[model samples]
Target: MTTQDLTNALNALSTGEHQNAIKGIKRGIERESLRIQSNGAISPTGHPKGVGSALTNGHITTDFSESLLEFITPVSESSTQTLKQLRDLQKFTLENMGDELLWPISMPCFINHQDDIVLAQFGSSNIGKMKTLYREGLKNRYGSMMQAIAGVHFNISFPESLWKSLHSLKQSNASLQDFISDGYLSLIRNFKRELWLISYMFGASPALCNSFLQGRKTDLPFKKLGKGTLYLEVGTALRLGNLGYTNSAQSSLRVMYNSLDEYVAGLKKAINTPSDIYSDIDDYTSEQPKQLNKNILQIENEFYSPIRPKRNANSGETPTDALLRAGIEYVEIRALDVNPFSEVGIDIEQIHFLDVFLTYCLLKDSPNMDWKEQARSTENLDAVVNQGREQGLMLNDNNTPRSLQSWGNQIFAQLTDVAKWMDKAYGVSYYSETIERMSMWVNDPSLTYSGRYVAKLKESGLDNGHFALELANKYKQSHIETDYSEFLKPWLEQQVEQSNEAQRNIENADAQSFTAFLDEYFHKN
Candidate 1:
């Protein structure tokens, strides 16, 4: 849809309506980190009890590795409230961490070796064992060290009221579930078409510890830094580039988001399909399972995409099963790199911009992506990640070629109108103000987080290890200096104790043998 079309639809949806689409924008953040010591090496400690049990805690959990702590905030409509909660979680976790510091960066700077990185250990329960086994499978398929890299997942969904309003505006005969699914699919399609814009603007990992390469051959023009750091002058996010979490076996997946059936079918096929390479691993017949059946995906979560159509699974239900049963509930955005500059890894401005951008994507016309368009998006993402800040950089906008600056300007121009409508609906100027400040990044690349970090590295001549250690220490001290919130202290303490009790109950209640448990889990497929 054109800009004018989206504006007309917004006007129609807003007329005689007491609710605003912007206010109903529910968002949650999942920020991941590796526990690091004062010297910036990955901490060998187990998950801290003060942080809460990884098994039962809804807010605090481990990602892939034991030391990699993931903090999740409950869904909130207000960006300020969401970020405050995230900060509170961070401060609480830091308080419980003792001498360990939260790694202040996305790309891990220091590591001992692959073997030094251990998979997260959940206790003796069948469910806990299954979770750890999944990580072990990932480690066996990829390497242990690769799973230790940190990033953030942004979970977002619009209110059903907003969707019903849109449905009424469309005068469609589709069921609510089908309508919502189709609408979200349209949003996903547009997101894929334009994701390079986000990568160029928000990408921050331009460099990383050289040890990440581990002798892999690459054509990237990398320059050596002090000690173990290697950098690319034009790189935007090396973490999103090559040396990050990826699955070669699953790259053949053509999970189209044009419709719910097609999307789910594609995912279903992948999870059921076997991988020849993975099948070679020796299954531990006498002992525990080494990896979940040598399928292309052990579960639906194994298929990595920048954005995912998510339906919160029921107890023991697979992600695909949930989507099939109840349709898409929300979307998970996995493209963003953790902003190292922010104490909590994200900020209000960025969240507001996403709200506006994603709203525009939904309102605008989105055609289904074909193979050619998908290939173009893949290439565009590579260009943005590798050399987005380079002068006169160009990306394909459909069949037409446009410079990054020109395309960004065009999007920002539309977003200005979107922001105005949001401000009017929400009765706040915060959205407009965010667009105004972020527009500067389009005109001046150096103002971008990645550009500034690259410049800082050049000036200081510090390796990734030294640079990140300094920031980690600084943030650690900052969190320490800030007084703990008296209001949240009791609740935080209760959550930790409650989660531990929940885990113990689950452990005590298990009736099935490990062999029977594994069989039942795979029966979902």
Candidate 2:
């Protein structure tokens, strides 16, 4: 599909119909943070009871460590509603945490040693044990410190009515689920190809404290700040590069997006394939297992990708099992950093822009990427993450090199029509406002999040740790002062009690041995 083709499709729809289509968009947010002390050190605090149980809480949970909290929102029809839900979560959490503040940056900077980070703890139920065991395997496979990095995941889906409209427009004969899954796969491919745009626009972690880089080697030259800070003058998001959620073993897995079957098969093979490296890490001959298995992957979620095709799993299903069982239900964008500039970690403008960009991804043509193209995509991503704002920077546009600015201009021009249509349909300027604001970043690199962060660091005369800590405290105080919705506080209180009861029920209901449970879990799908 071409730009003109998308414009024509939008033009074909009546205003009322377009309004309904726009209203069908579903969005959710999962924001992760590390609990930190006021003076900028990772907190060793336990999960607060007022925030609810990690095992059974639907909205709040722990990610990789005990201090790392992941706040989730229920699926909503509008970006405004989704953000409102996240705000309520933050307010409730701040009320629960006494003196600790949520770390505002994606790259953690205050750890003294890898041993200091505590692995997330869950209760003794079979499911909860498996969750913690998965994190333990991750820690053993990768260093515990590396797993402390935080991020924000945006989950998006389109209702069946919107897909039915597109299906009718294409006049396809494929089943609805297959058609939607294929469409999502295409979006994933396009997202991979163009992810550098997101990194360039929103990447914020340009510097880090020396503690995060302890006993590591680097090829790029970095400038020094106060005593402990080190930064690349033009680095966009170091967290998305070599230092962040990367695994050498999983890098060679070659999970393709050509089809749903191919993707599922790739993951299944990895889970079944034994790893010599992991096998040497632990001997599971004892009663307690060291890791889930000696395979390349403990589970499908171990494989890190900037974007994922997601399906809400049934009771005992893995992510791969869920996708295979019901096809792709939604796409989770895992590339976005924690934007410290915003109190909520993300803003309405960013969400609206993503809805527009993702819609464009669906309407645009995306060819299947082979191994070479995939490698090129990886190269493009690495370049943007390391030095996106460097002068005369270029990226691989399929095989040809193109200036990043030029390519961004081209995409933004196409998005204008999308923004206009959304504004007209919604009778508001939400989408148009983002396009207008973000277009300036394409023209002026200094306006980007990474650029502003570096400038602020220099102007404040504070090290990376101090600068982020200042913002964390500021946001914490802001959340504390802000009045929370009365309904939300009572709702959260009920959720806490309900989650604790649910965990108790699960503990009481487990009848099979854990070993037998593991065997069943691995074979059930």
Write the residue-wise lDDT of candidate 1 on 249-336 in tens digits: 8678888888888988998888788789888764423375788677888888888899999989989888888998999999999988
RMSD of each: 1.6, 1.6
Sequence-dependent TM-score of model 2: 0.97
lDDT of 1: 0.84
Supply candidate 2's per-residue lDDT for 180: 97
Which pairs of residues clash in candidate 2, taking residues 3 or more apart in a chain or in different chains?
none
Model 2, span 62-150: residue lDDT tens:
99899999999998886777777888898898889888899999999689998788888889988888888888888888888889999
Q: Which regions of candidate 2 are displaced past 4 Å?
A: 13-20, 283-285
Candidate 2 local accuracy as lDDT? 0.86
Can you tell me which runs of candidate 1 are displaced by over 4 Å?
A: 283-288, 485-487
User: What C-alpha lDDT, on a 0 to 100 scale, does residue 185 get in candidate 1?
Assistant: 92
Please give the CA lDDT of all the candidate structures: 0.84, 0.86
